[model samples]
Target: MNIVHILKKYPVVILLLLLTACEEDGDKIYLSGLEASEFILTETDILLSKENASKIVLSAAWKNNTLVVSNPDMGAPDVFTAYLQISTQEDFSSNVIETEGTGESKAYTGAELNAIARNLGLVPDVATPVYFRLRGSIGANMESAYSGVKTVYISPYLIDMTVGFILDKDKQQTGLTLASPDADGIYTGFVGATSWYNFFMEEGDGKIWGNLAADGSAFLASSEEGSWNFWYPEPGGCYYTEVNTVRKRWSAIYLPALEVSGDITGEMTFDRPNTRWYYVFNAASAGTATIRFSGQGDEYNYETGDGAPAAGKVTIAFAQENGQLVLTGAAGTISVQVPAAGECTLILDLSDPKNWTCEVTSGSEEPEPVAPEVYVIGIDDGITGGGWNFDNKLYLYNEDNLAYAGVLNVHSLWGYQIGTEKDNWGDVYTQAGGDAYSGTLEFKGQNNLAAPAPGVYLFDVSLKNLTYALTAVGDHVYVNGLDDKWEFNQTLAATSVPGVYSGSITVSGASSYGFKIYLVQNNWNMLFGGSDGKLTYGGADIPDSNSWSAGTYTITVDLVNRTYTIQ
Candidate 1:
């Protein structure tokens, strides 16, 4: 009998038995004899633009395909899956978009079509032929067939190019533009702010960027509204600025030569190795002398800041008080006396903002040159496995005071020692064995220094003072009473520079404004609070009084410098 005729004679029980037998033998019922389907386009030619981004630009539809089982006695599953594929190539070889769905039709919005066209390398504002087809599948892993291809002419739109601007501290436009060629979030351009080092950056879309603190360095930036204006230590003239919206970071590089004028005048020479500026000249008459520092082609008159060099012939110091230069000592006088009218040399060091200073030396005789020596942290005994070694170098914060500071990882009972020499076992500085973190250091102590416990520590030692201190470095720094709640809810994160931490906090208008930086989070025993830009270990509230109003601020703390800034 023919297979069709035999199926007509088979009963329900026999059909069930046949299906069970197929399953037992692990046989798949292949689908065959699929009916041809057609893919139809509602609008073959369409234009996509930003104006119609949300509107449907086109529609595609296909007829439902039908299939029959290869087994004459069995029936095929009625379930079917359809796919809409659009590609630039007629054969769908590359740059193809395939979407699977259960419906017979699909609609493409202007944004959807434009994105597809862009992905397929379609030229903008120009009609391009796009191929479309329908793929239908049935059974398990069975890709039954595909409909004939349909051609569609589509014109896509371009990404909106964005422009950025440079704004002064007062938010006034500076006529400088930062371009985003790729319409990406990053913007870059050179801005000649001249005397105006403090400024802000804004995007065409209303995004704004500024410095995190009022007295923050140029390298630090923030996009948060109401933040302080971007500023450098001194007027750096024109700068190549780059604002990255995606990363929320900005940077600027000053592009100008430095020069000095007034009592001692000359073009400053750049010491690349030392990262400083230097100028040597004879003093016409040194009686309450003043100097002005300016960048090449710069209109700003930047005066000398506080600097005192001990090794110079005549040690001079300068300080910035309310944006002006001043000289003061512990008793509010020039710490280093300026020599009588004679030849002198000036050194400008701006490499480290915390250690920014301008040192001037008098007389033709320069201080005797000495071999540069560095301090390192290591074990006490040289012969021991953990003895003195040239590792873990400390930072020299004050060149005049020979003060070195840095964080060191200490082990309990490790007997640590600070070595002046790099490799030799000479000049081993230490204190009598004890768990104390602060004490006087001996030239060659009989006992090695010991920590209370194993942990990272803040090590500050001054060879000039012959004293050493070790404080356990806390992992976090918290702002307490920022919201007038007397609580620690804001935590400052450690920045790229060690010993520096920064965070944002909001302050509400209150009868009094007070806050403190807690070395230990949520604790008051070890905290910092002070007035002006200086920080005290256990000083008073930050503002010193009720001088600040309600606003959000970025607070940065420099533990090594004992200073803090809120902007």
Candidate 2:
């Protein structure tokens, strides 16, 4: 029985005995004892209003109700340390402020309590109640129960200001000037009263002019009326009004009106009897115009008809010449051609009791012809291999057929659609049958076209022809195999020469693995796989009968020749 033999046999027994000895000697032991009793607070409720918040002090005092430890050797300290906690919530879950107690008393100055109220996000002039409690501790890990909760009602201070609206010398009172106790006292309240008058505020007196800051003033005007001028203390600045003709009101701000100058063109046709026609044109600098005729009217009615003339077809032509728009047409076709000056409407009074009269009415112009806008559709989902990002949008490649073409990587069964806008699904093109991909694509349909297999397929969607084609790649080729960890990430890059991609890769082990050539990395929708060293677009996986042994292989993919070699 040597020391080594004895220690190996009784290691656990020896360790337990040593721990017991140390515990008995009080080296690392703590004697269990009863906890301190709950404490009692002197005040449980307090009011901290804005009136008294600046003058009074917030204080709380607590008394220890439990019996004190009489033995000095028990390792308990006299006079327990206490902490006062203040919080906005009743449970004090967060945003709590802790204040240490001076013996049994804790005090907060008026300014301190007000800061706490503001930090709790209490609105000015609004009253909010906060909670407080005292927690006492004797030593590390020894805490007495919490004292009763106390509440403090606090309110913030608010400022008061006066606002008024002054009327101009026009003697037109826009509206009543409202004076209220709870008003926000902003300039919007004054200008919002009426749409005709512009309001401004002066510092000393309302009658004084040029004293008001331009930033502090606001104006209202009508939309139908392009520009208007109003006088405040001085002449209110001339501001273009944005008048809402529908609502018969204007915005609170002023904007300049846009001046337009251009030639106007329009057409008119007479089809019924006793029908009056009126048109207006705004000539910028007087240019030539062409008015062609197509329909004919009864020439006899123009000379004999009294009130409510009989229906007739008329041939007419209008041209801007000699600084005037002249109308030249066959007689009994039109009564007048020339129009009055100034922006006015040409009134063709066919309702005349004796004869037809045509004259200008007011001022206007015929709108110009606008060009059509072109919008490019976008490919979304797994089709683009970039998810549904609009930055990778597709465009119309062939206008004649109305076909949209873009490079896309399709999964075997994953579906996608074309959208009018990027990242927006409100308008899209889907396949017919609601769940099948056939026939033609419909707007906002439920079904989407799926790829026949996993690979990269060129998408040619023709809306005009109502057909789509998925062309596999024989040129822009890619190699996808076990070397890519069977994922899209490890695709081998190919060298482009003429019409084919050729590259070489090293096979590391003799373990069983399969690979194929693809047009896109990680895209299994279209691939080239075949037997007897022959590669075809969208064919089966290669090496049909046997697996290639571990070795470095040089491969050449010839899309022009439609062949491949491995050596």
Top candidate (lDDT):
1
Q: Write the per-residue lDDT of candidate 2 for residues 267-343, one digit (tens) a residue.
A: 44221122334356653433232232222322111122211122333443333344333334532222233344456
Give the clash count for each candidate.
Answer: 5, 20
Instruction: Give the runs in model 1 whose Cα sits over 4 Å from its true position.
Output: 1-33, 63-79, 160-179, 182-567
Quote the lDDT for 281 in model 2. 60
lDDT, candidates in the order shown: 0.60, 0.42
As a whole number from 0 to 100, the lDDT of residue 120 in candidate 2 is: 72
The alpha-carbon root-mean-square deviation between model 2 and the true structure, to one decimal in Å, is: 29.9
TM-scores for all candidates: the values are 0.29, 0.22
Supply candidate 1's per-residue lDDT for 96. Answer: 88
lDDT for model 2 comes to 0.42
